[model samples]
Target: MFHQITVAFMLLIVRALAHDSPGGQVVLTSDETTTQESTLHVVQEELKEAEIIPTVIDDFLPKFILNVEWSSSNYASLGNLLKVKRLQSEPRITLREASDSSASLCASNMTYIVTMTDPDAPSRDNPKWSEMCHFIVTGLTLSSTSEEASSKVHFTDLQAIIPYKPPGPPPKTGKHRYVLLAFAPANGTTDPLHVSKPEDRQHWGTGKEGHGVRDWAKANGLKPVAANFFYAKNKKQ
Candidate 1:
């Protein structure tokens, strides 16, 4: 099944990260409403056995809220309007390559890619069957042979895709905005990495726990920078 494949892929990626030369840390957390104590405990034990530190954020906290705020005037009852929601919340992408820093992705270095996805969508408020996004972050520096080539990307991998629906009597024309973010060490930075292929976004939101680029960066002592608005287009292959 698709779910199994996604979970397997996520596990493989995490395992790879644990074995990385400079071995990085991974933290998995759940929203307050969900009791993730047992799950977190298991993950911690596993990480410890593997010599990786794991952190969890289960207490209901404002900093962990993941929703968009619309204008007060435009905000109607939750049941009435089509609102934006996160399909994949917190998928982490790990890149491994032979570079000393983040500046060498373009220098003929091959990077390993890891990503996650969230498929949950809003209810009947909108007529669309599903609305989701994919995010990918690579870990090229971790795998690089050059000590100077091991810098992380300054941003997270982000891609949004919405299915098309027939307009009723009046065809409405408007735009929806999605955000792509990146996080890196304070002194570390890089120009925006451009994704020109649809396949790049397809690997997102496929993990047991949703992945967020910001969370991944923070766990790894990095800062996050987000791109405010991204427009999705309809293209035929």
Candidate 2:
């Protein structure tokens, strides 16, 4: 009976996500004490429906909830479309445990790395430069404390190895998927870590097929913990 209810509830979530306005604001409403795991599944389904899972990374199992706030009120909500101008600046990121939202996940001592990529670089149908590395930031640390439970804790010191480049899809290229992935030291090994920049944005320096986030993460001994993404296109197109 519980399984049946979960399935039913999930259907409602899917409908809500499907209907959310493209330009609508994404607000974090729940208290810090609990990050809803059900929401996590909703995000997972969004990725699958949008083909972000197979197109970029092969699979994803989120250990914690990743919240990305683009502006004061705008947050990354699944595959919602947004104007290119609104995403020019770097967005803030926060990670919270899925099991207990109140329980903060990032520790002061731990380091995290983030990567933003565009899998549908020129166009989804013909992606010669598939999986373009939009940006990469390392040396991120937890910057907030428990006292700010009402508010989310954001990662600090965004040291971008590959500086942020805003989405600029060519006119009439159709919509592009901008994916952000968060990684931590695999197996809790917290040594000073470094990620090599791709040879070029195109094919991630591997090939036309691309080296991709999964390959890069595995090579660096980092584990993908959480992810979020959005869609954008040249408004003129």
Candidate 3:
């Protein structure tokens, strides 16, 4: 009876060992499984971060200012001129010279304006519309003859027009283009126009009185000699 009991006990031990193994290999401990899961999660997070794209400032600059122009489409008249306002994302207008000058410096008190127009915008009768352009300008001064200053105004402080009402919705199935133009006086600081009201001037992102760059440029003597273009893509098919 004692020998029989010993054999049964040995068989039980072998069964338990086999159960703890998988595919003839020893099973991993709980801690080891947890560590492997954590490592995989970390690797996934790193891959996601690597896929993100970074936005660069120089990418926005136009290759040639001469390529800028106004749209010849009816969408220009869709919104009331008095009620038209600039987009929130694009707040400032700036101007830069084609060639650099040693004496020239970007300075504060510089003013700019931006305009968006879609010439190929589809009409009510036409279904297909061509792409449009967006513009931005920097490096404007008060007058043509004013001495160059080191501190220059950025697009943030540039003058713009913001209306009481929001801009009309974009057309269906068509991409809208806006042209941003930055202008400076050929001479310097002859007449400075205040584009914002006292209350409206304080807010940066809001559509305050001085919020539209295009409106501010029009109020001032700045001309649209140079410009950049951007096209808004269509999300729907």
Candidate 4:
């Protein structure tokens, strides 16, 4: 498997360094350190490219699993890294149990609000414009099907308060995480929500840090139900 190979490669690198040095004290020139760093970077990128890292538990917290699939056949499973072009269109979303996709959660007969946001607006290191709202759809509901289809939801059938904005990470800004969240009506209230778009994408229009889906959901009496996310970077980068 790719993961096994990556781990083996990393071990080999470490062993090589230890073997080359005396008494386990490895000394390297400036160029050697740069080369090692580059190699390590490649390993990290390969892990992401292989969709072996960045799980929902690792990236987004206090969240459940939501199945998000785009027309391009790319799925946002466990924070898999995807190309920006592949995510240009809105993805079909389905709410599922946090631990089981086949088993449905308590989302039946509930109207949901779906939202997408970028927690790393500029870059992970510097996210001054963090939590940028990318998409928001209200009046989303489950399809008219059997119990097995309880996870299915109608995304395109409703209107978006904040239209979908494709991921366009600036060149060399590292990878940005785009998270999709589904919120159900709070306190067993199923009335269609009259939500409005944020004044701006930055910080969900709060004009400050620490403002995003959680804040918006609290203000509108929406409860977090299920969520999913993906990573995207500029092609030029």
**Candidate 1: clashing residue pairs, number:** 38
What lDDT is obtained when candidate 2 is compared to the true structure?
Answer: 0.70
In angstroms, the error of model 1 at 161 is: 18
Across 102-169, the per-residue lDDT of candidate 1 in tens digits comes to 34323343323222222122221231322234444443233232332333233333232222121111
Is candidate 2 or 3 superior in lDDT?
2
Candidate 3 Cα outliers beyond 4 Å, as residue runs: 1-88, 91-94, 100-110, 120-156, 163-171, 185-190, 194-221
Give each model's whole-structure lDDT: 0.29, 0.70, 0.32, 0.61
Model 4 Cα displacement at 37 (Å)? 40
In the predicted model 4, the residue pairs found to clash are: none
Error of 1 at 142 (Å): 17
Worst 10 residues of 1 by lDDT: 59-68
- Deviation in Å, model 1, residue 222 alpha carbon: 2.2
- Top candidate by TM-score: 2
- What tens-digit string does per-residue lDDT give for candidate 4 at 154-217? 4567787988788889898988877777777667665557775688988998888746777787
lDDT of 3 at 171: 44
Error at 34, model 2, angstroms: 9.2
Q: Rank order by TM-score, top first?
A: 2, 4, 3, 1
The predicted structure with the larger lDDT, 3 or 4, is 4
For model 3, give the 10-residue run with minimal summed lDDT: 52-61
In angstroms, the error of model 4 at 156 is 3.1
lDDT string for model 2 (1-237, tens) is 895578457646555545774464333233453236665655666677788887787676565666777775466766667788888777777665555542343555777788888888788887777878888888765434352344543333567777777889988999999898888887665576777887777666677664577777787788877788888899877
